[model samples]
Target: MATPNELTAMRRAIAISAQGLGTTSPNPPVGCVILDRDGVPVGEGYHLRKGDHHAEVNALTAAGERAEGGTAVVTLEPCNHHGRTPPCRQALIDAKVSRVLMAVMDPTSRGEGGAVVLEQAGIEIERGVLEQEALLVLGPWLHSLSTGRPHITWAYGVDTDEGHSNQALTELRRRHDLVIRRDGTIEEGVPGGHGADSFRVPLPALGDEPGKALHVLTESGARTVLIEGRSNEAARLLADAVDRVIIDVPGTRPSFSLTGPGAESAVPGGFCLSDVKPSGYRVRLTAERVTQDQ
Candidate 1:
């Protein structure tokens, strides 16, 4: 059983993990909170990027001597393997943390065995504390690990005539691992500071689909692909590889519809409205494809 303090710390760790979404591709976003023996949080940190200090290290550094005999609540299991940085399990052991609470297990073979290492150091281990909630932050990374492909999302804004652009969509682009555009299209550059790699592919040939382009991108290790545009190429992606759709409407409309021939067919079977909320002056709608297994 998880104590309320531990659960709250794990939630904080999950929120901090989101800070690395666009920046930490190929690596899962991880967060950590250090709590003193009194169960009061002493330090909090999140992994910023590859080759940087991990969340546990940063949190431990912030806690300093307070980390000894404290609890470490982390969004993902502490890494055990040596990568760009040293294994986090060793860091926790060195910090003298007495207990560890992790929301999710590390799915990768290299990332496994950390809990064992910690347990051997005489640290109390608690797994699956708020596991489902952690998935909301770790979902795309886990999906990429499981399928060997990046998760795909189609985003665009609808205008009265020419489709307008949404700032939220622009921010989302920064978080993706890759951005896809049609060949010959002039680069307008990313709206905000860009973090994702960009690729331009020729339109899918007749009798072919845009999924082939996605395959190439995913093969290059793109864990989150953003298809942003209103061109025929974007339309074809909607028909083929999109896993989710995000639309920004100018106002509150009783109903919504996509305009184009075969637009309805382009959506994956079993897609249903998953979210509708207000964004600034506009309304944002999200639809996700649901498989039977779900």
Candidate 2:
């Protein structure tokens, strides 16, 4: 086990690695911590991109010979399988690492416990350090990996000074950047039903749909869709036809193929939507109820 200071250092290392996630695509985010002989941290790293140094390798390079007797703490297990780079398990062994601490186990079936790999190599291993915090950061990506889809996270900003209602408007507007805008034709999943201009509703009301159709309408090109946990029943109903799924809200994991009429959705109250500059074939939405939470 690492000392309190070493543990704190490990967390800082993970936070730095989290920033790399935004820029790294087609690869899962990872964080690593290298401790000195005395179990103090010497170096740290996170996965930053495809075809680049992995977190374990980067940390090993930074620690050099010092890694020979050091323990490595990581947010995710050292991957034993290969893809763009060599297996991280081999890198740690070559570095002469003596021990490993992992917060979360890799869910990939081929990624059988990194702790087991290190232990077989004669290094000490322990699992689950700061598990909850690590899971929260890793939740969406891990969920995506397990389900073969993209993770969806809703960002809501709100002002505390004013009442909750007024604050919601400001927050919704800022988070709209994460979504693409839809314009022109919006397709209904039902066959043989042509789209009608008169059928269009203000973008925000779409959120009231069983699946909160605002994001779904704009995501015209998405082959697989993951709806937030707060999405309406309409969105839930679309799940089976959609390529994949992700639920962001707490409680209840949804597993439906489609939404029936008059069903209720989980979209939060007070969300209103407006049109954005639609480019190409997409619908744009600006939320009326989002305030930046300071």
**What is the TM-score of each predicted model, taking all chains together?**
0.82, 0.57
lDDT score, candidate 1:
0.75
User: Candidate 2 on 121-232: residue-level lDDT in tens?
Assistant: 9998877877777865566467556644444333211211111122332332222112311222222222211122211212343444434453444333221122222223
User: Candidate 1: which stretches are off by over 4 Å?
Assistant: 158-165, 181-212, 232-239, 250-269
Best by lDDT: 1
Sliding window of 10 residues with minimal summed lDDT for model 2: 155-164
User: Residue 61 CA error for candidate 2 (Å)?
Assistant: 1.0
**What root-mean-square deviation over C-alphas does model 1 reach?**
4.8
The sequence of per-residue lDDT tens digits that candidate 1 reaches over residues 239-258 is 55577877666663577673
The 10-residue segment with the lowest total lDDT in model 1 = 184-193
